[model samples]
Target: ILSAVDTFGFHLNALDLRQNSESFEAVLDELFAAAGVTAPDAGYASLDESAKRELLVAELTSARPLVFPWSQDFSADTERELGIFRAAAQAVELLGPGVVPHCIVSMTGTVSDILEPMVLLKEVGIISFNPAQQRLVGSVDIAPLFETIEDLKAGAEILQELWEVDLYRGYLRGREDVQEVVLGYSDSNKDGGYLSANWALYDAQLAIVKACDTHGIGLRFSHGRGGAVGRGGGPTYDAILAQPEGAVRGSVRITEQGEVISARYGTASTARRHLEAFVAGTLEASLLDTESLKEPERAYGIMRDIASLAGEKYAQLVRDDSGFIDYFTQSTPLHEIGDLNMGSRPTARKQTESIGDLRAIPWVLSWSQSRVNLPGWFGVGTGIMRWAGEDETRWQDLRKLYQAWPFFRSVLDNMAQVMGKASMNLAQIYSTLVDDPTVSQRVFNTILDEYELTKEVFFRITGHDSLMAGNERLERSVQRRYPYLLPLNAIQIELLRRYRAGEDTFLVSKTIQVTMNGLATGLRTSG
Candidate 1:
């Protein structure tokens, strides 16, 4: 629907499972409605083979590229879902007039063993890769996890094994049918926790780059990132530039997710600006690869170590601490997320009360509400602060990283937004969920002090008051959203109290669902 001749674009490619029997004309009518070409549809879109083909034909005639839905993994039983995606791609290929079909692959956690990446390429016949490694580790500590160096070595072994099985090994090395490989970050980061996830991702990308270089593969990495930095959301321009040299070769693709899509692409001017940032960021990264920007190996190692320690502390708080899970579930509106019906994906994999079973949206959302925002910046400040105090060279490397690497810079930028939104005073309003006042106070005070110290360190490094510079619109938007959030928070608190006071189970469930709906609508993003 975005018609500007900018470096960005989007198209709606609906695959309806609820009503796959609808007629072609009826579906075309629906696309018209969803795209706002006609009016908003009174009903959701339907999925019919003929209808999908017709839509694809129409889109192709307009020179628009269509992204096929491949959200379901290989084991999906919804034959309709599987059939529609495969059929659409085949139609695109057979028509083959001028349109290029985009393929996507996602892994579901049900697989007892790791999935072979090449299976996706063989089955789909087109490569659109986004692996969900982070979600795989359900009950394990992911941070400081690789501190023994053996972890990295073992990871390398996995990389070698994957290289043997992946189509990229053949294609990047001059085999056929391999056009691109997309790397995922958000889900993986959530699974690995912050410190481990970030490092793991960096290592993975670096390894891929090495593989491509060694084999002469023309690889285009499409980053599956999200709206918040904790979910791999950050300043796009800076993040792209931070790529290890030779990793990015002008071509880049990243997901515009959740609240960020509306914030950046909601309007004409803002959308155009967003496109410009991508083009600008890609160019800057491509042009600038110099010695001054490189982190000394020793300094980088120290930063990694501090990050590992910090991540361990963070993981211990969330995963190992007793009653923290109860506090999380009872203190926030997370229980209601499953019933909210906001996203295409379920909130949990199965019926379970564990944090590992909880979806990342509600996980990040709860922390965001309590104002702890553990995902955005839990270990970072302590990691950096500790490193700076101990070694001057390490501190210098941190500064260079902020200035040079797009990834580190984006991390800091996201932290600033989190700080602006989070308030310890307001968080105290929600902390009353914990019956133990001493524990509540201890946790709250520790988080708040760390947040402040982190902000000071960030300011010292970036010399900025906040993330958005000269962006009054964003500031105003956050302010407006904050007031709206307060009502949802109060509702959640009341609902929780009643539920605990022996309220009817059904009523409690409905209340939780309603609270989720209101909060998601108000925030405009799940987290």
Candidate 2:
């Protein structure tokens, strides 16, 4: 029933080719130099954005490939980069489109960022420019990954511009004009605080959906989620239902990392249940009007203000506080987390003191290990308090929003769960590790005050005396987990002191690791 041209596998595999935009630029710089397209002194990366865009577009339309598979002129990094796409091409040619679905470029802020991967795919034979028709022949899709808060805000506009490019439009025709967008939660959360990042993501989805509708393009969103609420972790079912209307569109892809994958899908029965929940949630969200708010625009405006206030306060902590880094690195086992090598990527992009460079996983893990869990709920209280200052009507309106708006309810509830797991007591215990007592006490005191304020505001808005009041099962689980966490956290702190104070024995190191494992296990979904 199938011809050679039409036949394709349902899916052999669909692993996305993900790399930072900087890496793409580096590889291009080398390729342009090797090909004599640029002056030896002035490489591709040295060019301005406009010049780079013009060159990349021109390169995509050119008949000749940039890299010659047999050439040894390319730097080691360039060769390895080319080799990856080359292997992807081989897999796709052999297996089908399923082999390499999309090449996800991280930190994509411009049209050229999306085009860089297309050019690379061209060099590797994954794509070929057909001069006769002036179109591109390719099976792979170039998905732009918008990670930071600024990027998310600009994502829809970038996609709109990308679609307007003549060459890119032709390329999209091959894939039936479908575009995949990858949204990064961790960096967005890191850039803004919890409330701000969550709202931005939801708003970005809405904008992207509107843009796609206008362009008549099919869209699929791949969520770069992590295991902590700070990193977009929460109940899968609730998260799905909370998606802005038209966000799901019958297809969704969410990532699970670290212990989360095993916890969610380790056993056959649990896997089936989670699979069922995912399917049920996706279907319900796609078919039904999940976003039920009496005044959608009004709620949106309020949330925007709160997010702005929260972001400002969050900056006061991570960005403004001089002692924050010392408070973070010294108080928690961040250095030790690097040793775990929990994932393919490093804990930070490179050695840097700036919080922006540090990867979200370890940023969250350090906080979780210290029992601070700051990422999940910090700055929200002050934001909410400032907005509803001495106003009972405003507080009542928020309560109504929590009851009626699934998105609002989901956010507040998830934050509540993460906050409930946090321990001020244990956080103080870990604070003792800080070298400067003054820094330790000041930072810890600030955390303590914010913690109380956040809890107070959260309870008032939800009309609940405690966290996860609606979820008896989770509440019971947390209650069960806390006892084990106390002793494990205490032991880990002790071991950490010995480990840091020149007790370099394998016994101390291994025991510390064991404590980390125990803490991570007890506080399920922790970073």
Candidate 3:
């Protein structure tokens, strides 16, 4: 227990206080209003980008904070948020900087979004600017989480614009010129599908690196990965090594979600192994010149073609086909999974039927429970087949690329692992939960056909006749666990059947929840 406590820290890992950028802006607007400032009379949201930046810089650089003893007129939500930041400051002061190292602004689109948190931190005395000393004082890193494909594509420009601000530049100088930007894997995947998400993340990192280089600043990336292949889940070592050149200069941060945390760190030995792999991978990525492994120009073209084709196919099934959602919710134990008290975080970002609004954890977890594992490899086969069919030479080129490029190889290998875990026979069983036979048959058939194609392409590319051919230990482990998972899957299907058929008993719900947890454990993955 002491070992566990020590490993997890006083707070069970460094806490990062995060909120949408718009929330921070709202907090600031309240502060400005209480102070009787007319500059924001039209509201901060309506202000143009340049005007917002100017106001933010003025407020952040001022020795006087926006908050005062008389600033008690703010809304309850704003007060709670401010209190959270204040608590973070106090925590840092009491427990040292590691207690809360980051104040992340999610969905950060503009330069002002990055500055809004800094302004809030200054109000709580976590950050201060002294023009006389020509330096800035701060303990926490303000990280911008670029989540959408568009935000990712525009990441470098936003960072460059933020750095050009004199006050922010001073903060960077104080922090040793290192800036940490978080690339959100889950949201981007949800927004643009797997292929598009991967490519956008890579391209964003490359651009951000270039921007940092031009500005003579060191860059660090925080990867927001989940346990499923759809959410940037894969072998961590290979994933790190496959990063674009200069992306992982010396440091990297990744989020191991609750489900993955248990699987990877449930025991001392397992925890140690995972940590060692992370350190080893980071060291190798930092020191090795992986750029020489492949011709990047040629590789980039192939990847673009693959991502385009894959993204279109993914959208056709998930977004274009209206019946897919019904198939997904009915076939998987998604609703029951939400009722499980797995974590403090809410299951969905907002209450909505749209897949885009569904958080990635549940999105991937539901698929894992159903044994379809669609997020990991759904669109990949179509992408490969389309690319290869356009030109016969492309197939040979892909084989050569897989052999030569660690990035390409890692992508296919990770997909193969998820594909290996997928049991179509069991997936067929789950499909029975779908009320309409036509919808179930159509969607399941599409998924099954794609699964076969993915497996075939994956084997051909890797030159392996069987999945996990090189990893005997993993194969053996899977075989041993395979039988145990079948019972849980069977129980889940029955429970789902009864529950959907209007047998909405608490006992039935609880049993379904238990089975969901069991399957997630058996598979060593959740959302």
Candidate 4:
């Protein structure tokens, strides 16, 4: 029974020499020693000596895989150098014998120079291109950014050239090599519009998959998905099932982000259920019906175009709006979130006073706290409503897409859940935080109007009045806990007002933590 189940695993972080004084490699080695390699059911272990090796040779040979996260934009400082080396060394040692190492490339800081160095470290196996970096680039014309057929082909060509050359060949330090790349949805969509990021990623993955197939190299894709739809949320089963046939043929990995980690695996039973779901979903997707694959490519293209147009509109409203940032800061308790100090990383990369620099976590957190959850459904509601505006043909196509494509359907279902929990009226209570009535009215009204339209569309599509329609337990749970959570929001706002007034840390830290705990408990996910 244990062997029948796929065990759960957490992605580990290597202590970069720059980030830590302690040896991260040593720490990991210790973890491996205790945790054992290849999980018990798989019986994968990293044996140190001949006797131990002989004892386990029959049970395990290949090491469990390792996933590495690297910052592409790190400063050219001692720490950055050390971090890169530390991560690389760890992967070289830990990966193989059941370990697969992956590198996450942050597209923000030093992207132009990042790829060249990566070609030298081909043995590291997986390298990801994060579109979230475009958010930090502050580039106005972001349309030419999607990874294209030409781009993937070019990258592959570059790899082939490097493999034949001395510079990259010498740097690899003698190991067989293959590379995998990942695309991020959270940071990318948060920087770009939701639809834009989604399309860019879809296009990129499809391009890469084809490129690998043409080149006769194994291709693996890891999706950097967050907890909500706006941040790349979708149903795991359907999402995997809808993959472009061979795109996810053999292996895959995705970040289990905020709330999702707790929601899916807070307990052992839930963990088992979720793990089984992934295995089941992946297996099912690997065997999709031929009819779905036979659907005309033009049909898919039309949906992509509609999504792109809607994304453009979404970008206009959020990124282009002049005063929306001010309204975002004032209306939401975002200021306090920084004071909360919940995670290991900073909310923003620099200490600048702009929302553009803020990380996706806090951005999502702010809207969640305000009960607007603007990130999840902001542009989507408008896009969908407008999509329904043009003609019955488009609407019919969209409805059909929603019904036929598991990916599209999963997106809608996620939004439906997010929208149901969202309370624009409750969000309005915090509107006094904003001084500009026009900006407030526009932001607030736009969200409220879109919510009604979204709910209507959702009802029409699902033939259900509201989300969780048949699940009374979930609805009742939300109802009972909402009142408790509202007070936390109120307290969070008051604390933020005091902190901003130049008061000491006494109130802000305590009150913020209080609210964090309460919300984390009440909502079952932190705001």
| TM-score list, all predictions | 0.69, 0.96, 0.93, 0.72
Q: Estimate candidate 3's alpha-carbon lDDT, on a 0 to 1 scale.
A: 0.85
- What lDDT score belongs to each candidate, Candidate 1 first? 0.55, 0.88, 0.85, 0.56
- Angstrom error of the Cα, residue 463, model 2: value is 1.0
Q: Write the per-residue lDDT of candidate 2 for residues 1-527, one digit (tens) a residue.
A: 35633554645347789899989989988888888789999999889878988998899888776666575577788878988988898888877767787899999988888888888898878888988999998888888999999999999999999888888989998888889999999999998989989989998998999999999999888899998899999889999999988889898999877777898899999999999999999999899998888778899999999998999989998889999989999999888877773667787887758789798988898898898999999999999999999999999999998888899999899999998888898899999999999999999999999999999998888878888797889999899878777888889899899889999798988888888778878887555
Off by over 4 Å in 4: 1-76, 83-100, 108-114, 119-178, 290-296, 351-355, 470-473, 501-505, 524-527
Query: Which ranges of candidate 2 are over 4 A from the true structure?
Result: 1-12, 69-72
Please tell me which predicted candidate would have the highest lDDT against the true structure.
2
Candidate 1 per-residue C-alpha lDDT over 1-527 given as tens digits, one digit per residue, 9 for 90 to 100 = 24532322232342211211223234334434444434453422343434433433333223222223532232233333445546655644554412333433332111101222222122344333223321111110001111122233343344344345433243334333232444555555455556556666666566656765765555566676766666767677767776666657777767677788888898999999989989987887668763244444654476467667666666666667675666666556565555665667776666645655766676777676555566777666776776687676766667777776656665677667766766677677677877777667766776677778788888777877775553567678877887777776777777777776778488777866676666655544344
10 residues in a row with least lDDT, candidate 3: 36-45
Clashing pairs in 1: 20-47, 172-217, 228-233, 238-406, 239-406, 242-406
lDDT of 3 by residue, 453-474 (tens): 8888887677899878867788
Where is the poorest 10-residue window by lDDT in model 4? 135-144
- Name the 10 consecutive residues with the lowest summed lDDT in model 2: 4-13
Return the lDDT, model 3, position 468.
80
